[model samples]
Target: MAKKYVDINTLKYLLYDVYQLEEVLNQDRCEDHDISSMNLILDSVKDFSDRELYPYLKEMDEQPAHYKDGGVEVHKQVGVMMKQGGEMGFISGPFDYEEGGLQLPMMLYTASSFIQEAANNHLTGYIGLTLGAAELIINFGSQELKDIYVPKMLSGDWGGTMCLTEPQAGSSLSDITTKAIPQSDGSYKISGQKIFISGGDHQYADNIVHLVLARIEGAPAGTKGISLFVVPKKRPDEEGNLVSNDVTTVADFQKMGQRGYCTTHLGFGDAGECQGFLVGEANKGLKYMFLMMNGARIAVGRGGAAIATAAYHASLEYAKERPQGRKLASTGKKDPEEGQTFIINHPDVRRMLLFQKTVSEGSLGLVLLASKYYDLKHTLTDEKEKEKYGLLLELIIPMVKTYPSEMGAQSVSNGLQVLGGYGFCTDFILQQYHRDIRIFSIYEGTTGIQSQDLLGRKLLLENGKALQLLTEEIKQTINSALKYDDLKKYAGKLGDKLQEASKVIQHLIGFAKKGDYERFLSDATPFMEYLSTITLSWIWLEMAVNAKNALVTGKKTYSEEFYESKIHAMKFYFKYELPKTNGLAEVLLNEEVLTIAGEKEVFN
Candidate 1:
């Protein structure tokens, strides 16, 4: 069979069946929309992505934004896509209908966004930033602020960026030195330099709204003194028309990948002073910024997963079409009659494909599940249910953000490997996919940061309650799978893995309190990886059970080949992917190997 982009039917199955999005739509929060309507929106976006976005993907990577004279210029193609995306209403899907948004469920919105990301990742960054900014305004800004900003942003007349990182303070928000001084008006004058700001400066939109984090004058040091401000490139008047603002561009960064979106160094107060309004309360900037960061983190994770999925799909197509050496068992050497078989016939190629499939699909399923939880927390009528969903989301955020990021990169790398020498060349999209996906594990919070957040804050502060809740959910999933014969053995295996993972989590918690904090922290990344493996395994098993039920009941029509492929992916995950947890668990239990006291100069 000819290789193609992502299998649309498979995507539909994963979204509607595996994630139970239809059931989520029936919830009170989404009572206004039905599955058909949601599907229509998604189908349109998918079609647009396939036709309009995918073709420019390679060109955008090759012709990244260039810095000149005091501003950055992105590929002209990006502007076209941005305008099309804006016109399609994708930039405002989750906002209120009165604000020109479709008011779609978060799950559906995320699913649609995933298609765009898969088609062209760098182009998608613009939309991600815009959505993040709009969300920050909706959550924290005043009614007056919303009146001035939300409609313009929703209409795609403007774009947004998060300005938090500095040359000195990269990840340590507390160390940031950006200054915000109060003016006669309610607004503040923000003066600072922010670096690595994505979508920071672009011609695609009329103006750029920067959600900046800066400290107030004479305020106590660290994050407590920091406040979030709405700093626009051109300050809007009472009627929201553009007015002069003292925002300047210091430089634009040339990155390793995702070049279509401008990463820039922005200087405020360079010309004079940038007028800004406080978001939320003073000295609580980190709190408000976290709301946006958390949302962006999930978005980055989903972007990583989408890139991996696209690469896998592309590689799968390439493997099936590209003829190579015959199967290993074919001993006849020089038989021109036999000719060359497709690379898919090779075991190594199959291994790479399976690895990509397991990671990409599993990560996609996990992210969609998390997005559904976001919807449930906001939409569910039952207070306790909402609380449960919220806690679960909190516990899973680190995993959802980090796991897909770490594994998604690995998946894309394997995808490149599937293409042999072609994968290494710039001519193929796999190379660009690898470059684009590599940033996932680093941005949004490095894997290390997420690990510390997971163990230090999420697990420890809650007295392990969040983790326990997640364990129970996995247990319930396994319990439900017991009735299905196809999944019984896999469920038992998953149960054992979960039990082992649970033990590791408990042991790590006890170790942390024993004053061996360094030793315990040393294993945080591995522990996170272990937890992610088990969690994704449980999710894949749940999906497998659903697939099996569908197959048995004949409720949904599927080709024998497709059903077999689904079963193969599930088995590949369990047989090949799940067993790695034991090794990760071993490392968690014995942290001594990593805690070896060595001087930094020793390696040098």
Candidate 2:
């Protein structure tokens, strides 16, 4: 078992020093909770993660949830963990006290989630989806609908799923064919099949609630006419009895990793008796679903970073303990007096380790920034303040989802590489982590989907205000770093990248304006890569400034090694990763249409 999931010093540095989460806790929306209480909660969660979750991660991957009889049967440890999460109120930590929650700030809540996800993502998925479902009802469901659902779901007596994907549609949600027809009792009969539904049909809960998206009869086609429904595996009768609701589990997906979590294919109204209650109104389901989807997207980002961070630490420990070949200088020397050196001393191994470190730590920082923006958007009373944060959040969510996922996949792969042959074996945890994080870029929203959203909608919408907000933040970071001589060079480099990014975006916007969208969006994936690289550069610069301040002022909050390590990591990113944006931006500006339809005619 991995004794540590994440570096405690890094977590504390980012939470208290860089983000100032304590101030966020003191805000009007979350004033009831203070830093000391939040720290205690965090300490407890880390203990749970270390003792309960990490030990079972390997077992969960080896023995996944299986389909039997009529439902999916998961590992017994899953049940125990779910119950503990509920009883401790971790599932509802971000909600209000009136809603039976601890009402911690989103930053603190997210930090706690990061710890658990790093330990075991499969176990965390159930509670994450349940909280997301209950929050959906709290925001858009009617009072009666809330009465019928929220409590049991939050208490972990029932599991919840967002039933969005269909066999034929996949990421194209508008093509979903699920049907919800109205009945005499104001409920609708939901009939459809949903696939890849996580926590869809687990035995840990007494019943499962599926937030199904289906079209009402006589409604328009496409997403404009779809409505959301709350359909459960079992229904309540007038006598307050539990009865099967004709919701059937078709099969359980045998996944590569995160195997202990149930991913199911479901059939609704197979016997024509699956009744569901409407969430809001007809034709408005897609909008309401976005509330849950947006939150899930950010969670997916956090999971990617969390898992990769775990892999990095594991690899670091292995490198320190497993002594290997001699240093390059002594390779030819065959004297018995000299002994083998540790792998950490090798330049190439050190390079891979540094890459993993930068991606994991930098991605975590980016996600927390997004979480803070989300809190401000939802809680601030000032319209302008809300609007600023809202636009900023809207703009970066794609990068928030895509960058960590894509980069974390690479980061974990690098972690495995650092272990060499041992990484390929089942005995080491890196193999499983590599498999687990692979799904991050593919789920919630695929990288392709996120790329399109970045170039097509987020960049183009509101007449470029979203991009403007992003650049303004980057520029502000640059200004702060200017005062420090050690960081000014890297800050200037980031400024140049920002200017280059702006130029490419302006050119692409012109193509869209002139009805050349084919060329405008052809290279969207590369554009996403460019934006993500620049965004992380900004974050690294901010962190570097803070690290330097601590060192120069002789602050003893952390050891000198800690601050020096931070500075070195920042330098590594600028030296190696930041340069990636230049090549990607060049491809975007050159306007080469190499991958368009006509260019592939010869192959066919």
TM-score of 2: 0.98
lDDT of 1 by residue, 1-604 (tens): 1135566777777778877788788876567898889878988988898788888888888788988887889887667766887788888888777666777887888888888888888888887788788889888999988888877777677888888899998999999998989998888988889999988887778898999999999988988898999999998676957886888888888888897878899999886668888998999988887865656777878998899889998899899889987665456454666679999988889999999998988888888888888888888889989888888888889999998889998998998899989999987889888888888888878899999888888876467677778889998889878888777888899889877876887787786779877766777888888889888888888877777777778886667667667767888999988899888877788746534476554453
RMSD (CA, Å), candidate 2 to true, equals: 1.5
| Residue pairs in collision within model 2 | none
TM-score (C-alpha, index-matched) for candidate 1: 0.96
For candidate 2, write residues 1-604 as lDDT tens digits: 4556698788878888888887677678887778788789889999988888888899999988999997899988778777888988878788887776777777888889999999998899999988988888888899987777888887888878889999999988889999988999899988999999999987789888888899998889999988999998998888967899989999999998889888999999999999998998889999999966667888999999999999999999988888988775546654556699899988899999999999999999988888888888877888998999889988999999998899999999999999999999999999999999999999888898899899999987698888888888889989989989888898899989888887988888888999998888888999999889989988888888889999888875899999888889999999999998878878988955687787348573
User: How many angstroms is residue 361 displaced in model 1 relative to the true structure, after the best TM-score fit?
Assistant: 0.8
Q: Which residue runs of candidate 2 sit more than 4 Å off their true CA positions?
A: 330-336, 599-604
